[model samples]
Target: MASLLFYMSATVLFAQSTVAFNCSINPIYVDIHKRAVHGTDIFQYGSFIGVGTPAQNQSLWPSLSQNITSFASLSYCTNNSTTLKECTKSTGGFFDASTSDTFRELEDFNTLDNDRNGTFDGAYGRDNMHLYTHYFETDGASETRLTDVTIEIAQKGDIAPSIVGIGRESTVLDALYAQGLITGKTYALYIGHGFDRAKGAVNGSNVFGGYDSGRFTGEVHKYPMSPDTKNPMTVRVKDIIINDAAVPNGEVSLFDQAAFPDMKSTPTPFQAEITTDQYPLALPYQITQNFIKHLDAQKDNYWGDNSLKLKSQFNGSLSIVLDDGFTVTLPSEVLSNWSNITPIQDRDENSTSPNYLSTAFLGQIYLMADYEDHSFYLAEAVQKNNMVMPVSWCPKTGAPQAYQRPQQNAWIKQGLIGAVVGGILGGIGISVCAYCFIVAYLRKREEKKIEKDLERSKAAKIEQMEIEEAPEFEGPPKTPKTATPFFWKKRRS
Candidate 1:
């Protein structure tokens, strides 16, 4: 009787373990919604997330520099704007602390600087955060909710969008992993070319704990995450090339002295951080000037963000070469459009500026970060299909591998065809051929079932075993007093 009871208890435990393991292994996918925000002429791409206890919905941009999720507080718009209409338009959406019953303020209103030229006055607090799979803010079919997640309510700051930070510190990803909602503390991003939806642009993808294999193409280049916690995702720019007719090869390197003899010095490879804070590829002043001169671009004073307007639209394409031999080419439309170009200011002979490969650059490549493994990968962006294959990055799995479709063996296909033809042509041994085919098919099916069962059994065993403690993540370093804060310059007219 004791042995029977033991067996029943073990079965119950195994069933519960399997259920928990399956839930943890599934990844959370957040789709980027293209909506007409008040300030911008072109449509913006952002994820619509719900915050607070009552679920105040807000369209927040995914920020790499920020450590916690931030919302424009009710005070921010009331103090900054003259009217309610302007407030809602400018702030994307605001959160009322009084309305949320679960909100608990941890820190009073204070100035917060993100080292990346982003200085804002905000109050730190803990609240319920919700991530939705649907693009619409109203819909909540498959929502992942976390209670008492750290958040910031911004009162006043530079013209910026409310952002959900996916940084190196204890971010939303970490919270999800800790709660066993996700398999690992990792995420992948594919900022689609959906800025102008009218012109065939599609919504971007932001997958937590895994990557959408269909979003990228070509060989994926891997790199170790930067030691600088402030800028974990950094890549070196080797050369900038433009398609030029006057040149012998119809391509001219911006760094080549022969091409631009007036250049004071030859530009060397420089590191740039990949961020989603803003659009435009922020390069060193020298490189920016070289690009401006080559393209005959002029400053758009109206924009007030150091945006360059092309005098005569450049018809040729522009290509950026990375240190790893990976190249990303931009079409003539991107080069001609003034809104797509911005120069890194305060960067000259003596001074240096924060070089960034911002949102615009992300539209052309796939970015995947494995915080646990301290590694990241980049691949050419592909939008050929909307197929999604989410690969889980469990603690046991370490790093999530990109999914590849299995190619069918030619021999198997040929053999099957030969068997069918032989059966039809020659009556002799027809029954034997049919029996063989049925046996092979049944064997393949049975093998698959066995493999799945084995995986489930292993997962249950792992769940039953004691889990090892993960290494502590290092905290962000203090921001320098002299460091300039970068702000989102987009504002309503």
Candidate 2:
């Protein structure tokens, strides 16, 4: 059971169903096991089914059930566009409400089910995991959307603070390996450090409070009455899976981008865009945009199209949030020209690819999806424009919708190279076969012709002999003299 559960969790943890046709083998499912390690010494865990979507105030996600269904119905293609079914209840994008206290950070996440209990487990061990579907997309009431999608990830692990990380440092991998227990074992990975305040980005409603140190004090400790300010569990996931779903389609174009309040600045690379009600990093501030200029990364906060529509421009006041929970804002004229990024590739290229960037410079990037309100990516950290988790994104501009093979002069040239090679091979094969057949046929025919010619010559020679003998026999004199000897008696008489 444990092994099965673990496999299931791993499958969901890293899922990408939008690429493959098989619903069972999707990579979009994010299954997390929020287990508690028995006590402070150990941990316990639980299983969860989740859509690979991020949550925040005023944030939205696609209908997990609907999208999954629609994906299942479609014939899977590496180059195709998939439209999610309308949320019958909402009949629109899934606008997920902020699970995080973006608008109001609880003095104690303890009351907030802090122990990674998933459900109200432990002190509030109701042992229940919450299920939510929130999405927000602007369609003509109902319209098709184009976002790269496929499969789902299912995975299981102690997605909690079980094996305490000995220390804090980026370069401590070697040291941790030195500690056989730490290196040999594995763990789940969680991002976000607690803060005192939480609130929104527009006015300020995004913030949370917790100890600066990575410890789960609020939920895991014996003290329930205390706030949920415990350090976080550093989890290292075991497996990751994704389905490639980069269909061939024309991409969305960009028109304009502007922040309501024009600020004198450029789109900072690796910058964080925060939006909270009243707290630290709530307002859109220009931190460094760590994302690179031409590389693929998560939450790459650039002034590109947020609305995933063809010929549409991203006009929302959307900002980028970082993994550490920072945000980056866009000025009206900060971003222009959408040729920086290529078309959206398959899921694996966006997720597990070595070039895949880390967490968005901001906590999460803000982009647009079709029927889906917002799509998010939990990219790696320290990636310059590398790691990004967009609240939503589409290939409206810089990001293309399909892989672009270089333009050729004509259709014939499209696969000219391959065709040429194939033609050469075919010609050789035909020539060899024809040569052998013709050689055999000619050899037989030559023998028959030679026989006929020899017969004709022999007939001519025999005819000549008969004609020459007839001419010698034509003279009559030689026959009588020899015969007279027999009549000597008559002559004497």
Best-matching candidate per TM-score:
1
Global lDDT for candidate 1?
0.71
Q: Give lDDT tens digits, candidate 2, residues 385-472.
A: 2111211111111111212245677646788877888999999999999999999999999999999999998789888863233322
- Ten contiguous residues with the weakest lDDT in model 2: 203-212
RMSD over all Cα atoms, model 1 = 36.5
Residue 144 of candidate 1: its Cα lDDT?
Answer: 88
What lDDT would each prediction earn against the true structure? 0.71, 0.23
TM-score of 1: 0.70
Best by lDDT: 1
